[model samples]
Target: MLYLTIDETNTLIREARTDAFHLEVSDDHSAVADETEPMRRVLAGLPPFEAGAYPDSWREWDELVSELTNRGVTMRRVRVVSEPLTDYLRFLHGLTDRNARLGEDIRWLPRHLVDQADYTTDEWWLIDNAEVAFTIFGTDGDFVGAALTEDPTIVDRCVRVRDALWSKATPHAVYSPSGWSG
Candidate 1:
């Protein structure tokens, strides 16, 4: 199933969510170019973060993670990146601790540190360790939607790949894009 809009994709993700939801994020500078954040800030009347004040009030993020984690749902993610980190990645770094505090375990793996052949290059979600949703991005780095599937083989492969990457990736707290090592 292909979700053509963000709302449709969000709905599918929320509905399909189970006890444990894992994510693998490997993207370009999508977040910085994303239209949602600016609109979200406007709706909340929040000022643009200078360095993204950590523990900053992103109500939706706080509420969702708070709700899910309180319900004992496990959320974890591994992000693979090519260094030097993109501007969006550097920006995202400041907000990750908020996620860690909310019970999500996020790890970062410099692309040079991993075997390129072992993992998928694009961003994806392995929901409940049961389904695979491959994100589609436009040339401008805006998210278009996703190709979602529940094929057993695809699910199995994602699980395996996620495991391999998650094991080697550095925890977000310990990884500094500026301090990347070969």
Candidate 2:
């Protein structure tokens, strides 16, 4: 397990993600709002990922996604959350549309729908069916670091976990965290 600095991690993912046939992310917690300068403003008062706020950063991210998808990488993210969403979920829900628009597929699944034995409580990214980058967070959901590995068995485990949860998850467009009946 190699610990990665955030910048190195981002560059690694940016480069590795392009050659992958599929890239999947499992987000089990509300992401840290203060991780970036732009997100800090959203935490202050701006809407989530509001277009005009962080023009440069937003363009960079958008361009990265475009580049990856143009090269045939299929990116999908599955957020495992309890129903009758939490305040943070509602906050994150606001960004799914923008994420989808950027060419990544997004899904939402109630915690109960996933098999407990096959899922992880932590956030992770399974890339190219051969690598897993597990995100580590501090007690307050602050980003700490990442552990990246390319062991085939570990990657296989993540693949199964992603497949099992994704099979029962709702695609972003049809998912209504605010209006869930559960």
Candidate 3:
């Protein structure tokens, strides 16, 4: 169970050979402080800009995803969200189309559809089916560090869970976050 900094986790994702799968179960992740302005704009009913004109933060991620896609590394994410979307999730929803266009396969699963006890509460990244990096968050959902493991037991279990959730989630292109009243 080795601990990793955010940079280290990003490095792991960048180095993935075949696939990078992420599972996010939190409704609000305080780690995304950089997105505050963008989120505020979204919640305020502002329209998004052209992808080429997006903010630097978003462009940086787009570049990474494009690079990975060029390298033939498949990237996928499944977010388990509660209804009446939180501002954070709504922000993410606003950005999902761009993310999908950048080569990430993003999906959303409504919380009501799954048993809470069936999944791990932590967010995690499974790199190439070999390593599982579980994100540690503070009680307030602030970013802590990450626990990374290559232990087959942990990695295999995460793979199973990811697959199960992925199969059940709706693809981002078709899923509307209609629950967001704001």
Candidate 4:
């Protein structure tokens, strides 16, 4: 089995979008940049993001925002913040006023942290597509990389960990109130 810390997950997510997609993110606030952010530094590419979620940030740039304009990407946001998610939702709406297309490509998945129990459609979907799985450490953790196989034993183990979080996770319905409040 291989493990991917936050950095690696960021890399893959940047690479995985071709059409509509799903992403199950953990409850960590360490912001990371995938290709979109770096690519944006030079030019505007890709239009419309698929489905995904993230906390709100006051930071100047957000990969989610950049990805939305990408017709190639369809973004769904689940802001795991300490404040009422409705507030974040409102903020997103505000952004739409400025850029109508902002609302066009992005959707707000039921905002919730990945649980340690059951898996969401998004989680299972992500795993199914993963020819390889990377275990991303949440805090002070390093990258552990392992290739996934169709083998029952390996797949079972991966399913166990993924399910653990998936079960305990709150659907984009619960608010954590710390990560994104801006």
Candidate 5:
């Protein structure tokens, strides 16, 4: 097993012409406000590619989605959350610009969190597919962080989560919103 530190991995990705980077968020690192800037620079160096996110809180801002669209990357969102309401889901949809939507290639899936508390089985799966996970540690480093992983299990879990949600989610192409005819 090869191991690359965060800085090393960042440098490698920042220099590459193209690559897919998946990020998994936890409350600890989710507080960073905006991770999109660094990701934009990192993505700019890459060829056309994909990126996935399991965003938490403000991490699901429209700005980040817009940034991803501007970067010419395909982004898929699999919401493996167990919340009482789906305010975030609606917010994401609203953030999507119709003009950019066709080019941005952004999709969201709302998953059924059957058993988990704050996370789902699929969320853990994303952690596994990350090539190099980034975890921002607090001054004390008390398990306060985020990370990316390249483990097969993690990747598999995310796929499963996406599939499950996709199957259950309303097909946007078929279901038109208010005032729009399909």
Candidate 6:
């Protein structure tokens, strides 16, 4: 029942010992302004974001992922997106290569392929399989805060969901957004 600010969540992820799993169930996260500028540039027909480019927030994340990977910690993310893609998802798809290159194993899953009843609707991060941090978003799809718990029941469920979805999702390198429209 403990709540964490975004910075605290980032610290938790950075301190993960062996594994960190992120399950992104939403298609839009407009409140995360870190990528706002990059998204704007791309949407306006400009070049996509580069690793060290604008929005220092991304650079911070890139460094964290790189450091975690160097420490042999596995970081994985599964994004469950509905098609045709939302503009935000499309924006994310374009920027995923940087994440992959930085050592995160990112995957894309078509929402239709999943049985929603089996998973929590909220987005979450399973840190080293010992704790779960559920992301709380406002009605407008803006992230508000995170609820972190170490309860075995909830953590176990997240582990199961992560394993099941990871197996079915397509790796970022192989996924194609060709048929989808924003």
Q: Each candidate's root-mean-square deviation in Å? A: 5.4, 3.9, 2.7, 10.7, 11.0, 2.3
Give a tens-digit lDDT track for model 1, residues 70-175. Answer: 7777677888877787645654565678688987788988888887656876677777877777878777666677788889998888888888888899998788
Query: What Cα-based lDDT does every candidate model obtain?
Result: 0.67, 0.68, 0.83, 0.38, 0.38, 0.86
Can you write out model 5's per-residue Cα lDDT over 94-182, one digit (the tens) per residue?
34444235333333333342333333422221222344334445565332334556667755655554455545544334433433221
Model 6, span 45-69: residue lDDT tens: 6776665565666668889999999
**lDDT string, candidate 2, 1-182, tens digits:** 98876665556557755433232233334555442544444445666555655566456767777777777778777888776676556556766688788788888887777788878766777766777888776797666667889988888888888888878889989987655432
Q: What TM-score does model 3 achieve against the real structure? A: 0.87
lDDT of 1 at 103: 78
Candidate 1 Cα outliers beyond 4 Å, as residue runs? 16-27, 30-58, 178-182
The top-ranked prediction according to TM-score is 6
Global lDDT of model 1 = 0.67
Q: Which residue ranges in model 2 land beyond 4 Å of their true spot?
A: 17-46, 49-51, 55-59, 178-182
- Across 1-182, the per-residue lDDT of candidate 3 in tens digits comes to 99998778778888999999999998987356566666777778886553455677566678889999889999999999998788789888887888888889999999888765457777899999999999877676556668999999889888888888888899988887764543
Overall local distance difference test of candidate 3? 0.83
Which pairs clash in model 3?
none
On lDDT, the leading prediction is 6
Cα deviation at 159, candidate 3, in Å, is: 0.6
Model 4 stretches with alpha carbons more than 4 Å out: 20-71, 78-182
> Sort by lDDT, best first: what order?
6, 3, 2, 1, 5, 4
Clashing pairs in 6: none
Clash counts per candidate, in order, are 0, 0, 0, 45, 11, 0
Between prediction 2 and prediction 3, which has the larger TM-score? 3
lDDT of 3 at 157: 84
- Assess every candidate by TM-score: 0.75, 0.79, 0.87, 0.33, 0.39, 0.91
Model 6, CA-based lDDT: 0.86
